[model samples]
Target chain A: MSIQDEFSFINQIKPTTVHHEKTLITGIGDDAAVYIPSPNQSQIICTDTLVEEIHFTSQTMSPFQIGYKALAVNISDIAAMGGNPLYYLVSIAIPSSWSEQDLIEIYAGMSELANSHRVDLIGGDTVSSKDSLMITVTVIGETEEGRQLLRSHAKSGDVVFVTGTIGDSSAGLELLLSKGRHGTFNSNEDFLIKRHQYPNPQVKIGRFLSKLKRVSLNDISDGLASESNELAEASQVTITLNANLIPLSKELVSCDSEGAIEKALFGGEDFELVGTMSMDEWESIQQDGRLQNLIKIGTVSSGKPEVLLQLENELITLEKKGYNHFKK
Target chain B: MSIQDEFSFINQIKPTTVHHEKTLITGIGDDAAVYIPSPNQSQIICTDTLVEEIHFTSQTMSPFQIGYKALAVNISDIAAMGGNPLYYLVSIAIPSSWSEQDLIEIYAGMSELANSHRVDLIGGDTVSSKDSLMITVTVIGETEEGRQLLRSHAKSGDVVFVTGTIGDSSAGLELLLSKGRHGTFNSNEDFLIKRHQYPNPQVKIGRFLSKLKRVSLNDISDGLASESNELAEASQVTITLNANLIPLSKELVSCDSEGAIEKALFGGEDFELVGTMSMDEWESIQQDGRLQNLIKIGTVSSGKPEVLLQLENELITLEKKGYNHFKK
Candidate 1:
């Protein structure tokens, strides 16, 4: 379909109302979307872009998976900041060769995710591109006063924790590369593929954590090592992580035919939350029934900003950090 | 530079803070940028994307101009909603062929615009694309509660008006295509080229119109006919535009060597504001010396939503509407 026709197609399928956010004054069909923030709430904003080959490929991901993961990444950023996901704007660049069915499925995937999160897909722009498909999603979320988390708030002696599993996405991608989409897998292998294809951003846990005082947070998209370095740099502290304490799913552990710890440290695209909090704060949150599995894997120290990995009886500084865009 | 290194480059140059607004609780260096909206204010959000060959080519635009125009387009969306431009998130897909200098210049151009508007560039994600450069800018603006304009609120019998000239960008593109970059031009030709390269979003005018009690507003990105059609369709009223009343820049008038009226009617990317207001509202606005040039080009009448162009002695329905993405 032509760009104009694609817009009309989008309008036909676009959701008109969000589940509960009545603050949307006007959505879609206009110059921009207008919305009101709830009383005494702060807005948290973030954006992420996914390029065809750079972020995903047709072999490993369907059109629906592409759309689903594109929004998932940005929502992860909001989740890391301890905000409730509310609205998202998607900008897509479509090559002429892409079928109408492909575009429809992409939107359908996004619609499904939006419905699950109660986040409105308010407005977007569509344009033609000469190359592969590219999608950019910007998420707007809200947090009550003084509840938002920041990367620059990690305090000395604070404990570091990560939600869900680390390195599963990287392992999943590895398996997909070797086996292709049609490869048969048992439940363990299927879990890895699912983890890579559909990352669940920890929004609920993030919101719950935001209400507690004195916590620093970030999402691990660029691997745990890179994110930890960023947190240390932002907070002007050093993060010392115990490799043994890092959480690994049973599927990932069993699939560690290669360097699993290395993947956990430096591989990218894991949409899990990593954060730091004082022992008291962490203990208080642990009391909540929902956070029983929150893993304490490290501690923040008063030192030059950096990330240090502690293995059995030895501490090593990782020279090769997470995936760098310019590095081959 | 790798993506992480590119981020550091962005940080070295990104604006530290906006001029007056301190609602930014945190900027950049975070999982997501957090900001508090001012009391009784509604957030107006919009996004626009520009692809290399689709939006502009190196033959017609410089990296600086591309960066400037990308943000300018999003600002126009905010202006259309009658909101004050505040913060923006930029997600760019840079091809490997682009030099670090080219990327730096792009950010410099965006920084120039952001500084002028006092809009903060809080955060963004950068990724590698194998093909062309892509930019997606999402703008966040604010206005007093209930003050923002909407495309759906135009009342029947309201007067339709537009700010500034129309069709200059389309005409400018035509000139650039025929003349090439080195072609000589007088003041008028230069003005057209400038118009095409850098559109000044009507932020001040939009804010003024937004403060008014009753107004329906939109920006003319697609031609006058297309935008009018959208307004008519949105407000559920017929919009009758008088061709003679449509305002044209002096440069556009003299430069229209062929079918200037057609360009004014159906050309795209004018970046001017087209809105509708009641007679009393128009009269009150016209009384202000600042709004003396706001021209009444059309009227909203009770009928099926459509746009009718009044010519010399007859009315012509615009069958060839605005620029459609997919249509040739």
Candidate 2:
């Protein structure tokens, strides 16, 4: 198909939510889509960009996988905020030699993930590049009145909880590298690699937690230890994490689990939920069936925000090192 | 700085407009942002990407220029839709070596443009790249209640009006290339090079035109000859241009006076508004002080969308040969 037809088809996929009551204005075909701001509910907008080398290696991953991961990562951020991800816009740049088939696969990846999650691809821009590929996704999500969680609410003597297993991405990366680069064949591989490729955002979990008024939440894109540090800094309280309660994968047995622990605590791109709960509500949290697997990684303290591990009856210090967008 | 401090700073830059009265729940620094769909207004969303070496060459432009141009281009899309721009989000991927100074300049450029247009930046993502830089901006704008303009609204006998001088960007690009190749410059030049460096979107003019009952507008991001064809195709009508009335630039005129005609008609990236107006209210438009400079460049007809140039009383065919994003 011609380029015009491709853009034409792309433009036709506007936001399908019918807003015939309020002052509904513009959508997809325009240069910029306009919408009336929600007066009753505040508008929640967030954007994230993924560089080819920094986020994913195209040599090993398929175009569709990359595309899906791009949207999924950003959606995870919204999930951390306790908001419902509704619409997303993507900006993609690729080499000129990339055929239409490649483009279709890339979009197919994004569409597959987005469709399952009910995310509408409202709009995006695409242009040619010289060398590597880059994709940026901007997600728009919303929360109910007073239900949106913020980092400032965690008080002294609160409890910290995290959802799902962590550090698998770091472990997955170690395996990929030890096997020596992108396309290293691993016929025995299953969940670890898939977690590395298509990490799921805990959307329902975030929404469910948002309704529990006393907790503050944040997603662990940059890892639990780092994100917990952020929560502590944001809430102005210290955290004492139980070294034993941190979850691990079965593959972690006989491995450098300490190093794996560090990776799970400090490694970036895990995409899990790290949250704060009040002391009173913390006891009730143990009784909740849906949150039974939600592990208490730490507790908010009265002192300066510090993460300490109780190892064999002695408290050991953990470093606050995590991902940095720009570091030499 | 702490993550909470970052959120504190980022929260200050959100769009506050009349459309802010409805369903969007919240924006930024939360687990997930929430957006309640409006069943009233038509929601339009689009995304675009710009890459190094393709959209702009780093050797010729600074990071600030790149950043400014990125948002400006997206804002131009809002202008194309005849919408009032509200806010925007940014996602950038740059190499590790890119300095803090470079980021400051880039944000300064973007902030200057955004602030001048009263568009707040809600939130964005930053990631490092291995090679070149990539910047993506998504702008959100809104039209007044029930005043949205559309390409589908153009009808037979509506007069076509185009704002500002066309092909100035093409002329500016030529000057830029000349400076690059020859290592010499036109020191007296003012508007020519600036046009290429900073494209101004006619958002206010677009919003104003959207108020008119029969206005069907789209910005001249592509060449005038090309956009007219789109408007015609959308309206299911033919178009004929008044060559004498087509706004021409002095820089274009300086480059072989006769050739100016061709450049003004086909060269793209002008960011000017091109729209159709019905004859019913043409008298009031003629008397408006702010709109007097708007030139009536063409007329709409009943046949298939075809461009014809009226030169020296001769009806000569003007083929649609303009910006093709894929081919270019």
Candidate 3:
């Protein structure tokens, strides 16, 4: 885009109301954004990039969904850290082939989610790219002092739980890839597709869990197997997951029990909360009405770092086979 | 790069020490990095993207220079805002052709600069790209409350000043583009090429200027002509720059004066500070021995928002003709 076009695009997406006006001294239209941090709060920051073709195809995702998911993934990181996302910066490299309208739609998608969580768009860059479109989002968040959750805090005998269904997103992606974009889908297929296109980061659940004593948390970005392995390795413990207890969406299970289980084990991009907590803490969370969907999926044990799946009567080691960008 | 490769790269670049241990709660190897903000300080944040071929070609820059320039530009933004850069996040999209050693060297370039400023590498993402490499850096900084310098704070009777020399970078770029990368060069040519490859962001000068009574600041990333117009328009004033007074490096002036003037006016990526301050404040800063290189280039006047260049005997309106990514 021309400099004028870039400026116009920025003006279009410039936020009208900053959620934390007291803290946000400057948002857009400046060399850098300025904000006053809330005293005694720990700040959370993370960045994620979405490259066209590699992350999503136009056939499978609209520009709106692409933008929404880009920000959603960053927010999910903050959720995994037990923080509330407060501000975000987006740097988008656009190809000449894309229209301004498409860019605006993408920003709208991000704004919808940002407005919901009161996150403000602070500062970003808009530049032209030679070919594919790329969006990199950096989110800044905050939580109470010393309340940040981590992957290394899982203790032996902690009950492992996952919030909401797993494998739905990967199943959705599979359906989209197998059946062309224009194909009509049943209600189940539509739900699965939506799951893939629009992920809801578990911010509230993460915050609630962070308030509990002695909890370790991780977001299900990569598959359960990979994430479980990470948590186990970080905590230096062995995690045993019950195959039957792994949550699967009804739509995912309808395909085939074995296939759904496989997807749950190795498919990724679920944006769900998975963590280990003391049994008493888990029991206390179970009594909360909002956490009804929380599922007990495994147990942590003091042993050599590894992830194991309890399948039928056999104990099998789970491999880290989630999406690897350079694995080919 | 496989998942194993990505993990190994992360391990390689993982920071050994955090500069601000009290505020930095978490650094790398986490879902999101956590830090505590300095009490009562305003946080400054900005992001910039450097795209392959568009921003720099492999022919024009080494991978090390590419990485160094990527973070430097973002640091320049924070400097422009009168803040001390403390932490940064980098997201790099690599092509299959790049070796692991090249990536490591790129990180080393960034680490060299980061260590000088005591800035910490907080968090980032490394992913594979289909073709060209793309690097985006987001910097977080801070300044004392309400001390941010802005583009809109200049007033009538303010004297416009530029820190250090201008046009050297663009002149360097011209030499590189015209003579090609491997050609032998004299001392002047070497100096110009180094200026193009490595820019020093004026962080100290910016902080010094920010402490003044009132100053309007901008970094010359997009040429003085464009930046002058920005300050003029933002402050609702007219800026008149004296062509005779525009600072130029000896190497740049070794070329024709007209050509040097052209480069000084419209060429960019200097990362030098440009601002307007009250004549008294300017005079006070001039007395500082370290600020001897500061040049009085223009004056701000109350008039229609525009930029004008005062030539030998006439005043000509300067158009916004800086580098535009999509102008072609």
Best by DockQ: 1
Best by lDDT: 3
Which digits, one per residue and each the tens of the lDDT, describe model 2 over residues B1-328? 1222233334443334423434444444444434454434433444566677667775546778777888888888877777666666777776656665676677778877887887666557666677777788877665554666777678888888888888777777777666652245563244666787788988778777877777888878778888887788778888889989998877667754766677677888888888888876565777655465578888888987777788878998776677766667
Order the candidates by TM-score, highest first.
Answer: 3, 1, 2
- RMSD of every candidate to native, in Å, equals 1.9, 4.5, 1.6
Report the Cα lDDT for residue A249, model 3. 86
| Residue pairs with backbone atoms closer than 3 Å in model 1 (clashes) | A2-B326, A3-B325, A3-B326, A4-B325, A325-B3, A326-B2
Q: Candidate 3: misplaced stretches above 4 Å?
A: A1-4, A287-292, B1-4, B287-292
The clash tally of candidate 3 reads 0
Poorly placed runs, candidate 1 (over 4 Å): A1-4, A287-290, B1-4, B287-290
Model with the higher lDDT, candidate 2 or 3:
3
Residues A272-321 of candidate 2: C-alpha lDDT, one tens digit per residue: 88888886677776666556557887788888766777766989766666
After superposition, the stretches of candidate 2 with alpha carbons farther than 4 Å from their true spots are A1-28, A34-39, A180-188, A254-258, A288-293, B1-46, B58-60, B181-188, B287-292, B311-320
Q: B274-308, model 1: which lDDT tens digit per residue? A: 99999888777667665655899988899988889
Which candidate, 1 or 2, has the higher TM-score?
1
Q: What are the per-model DockQ values?
A: 0.74, 0.47, 0.71
Q: Output the better candidate (2/3) by DockQ.
A: 3
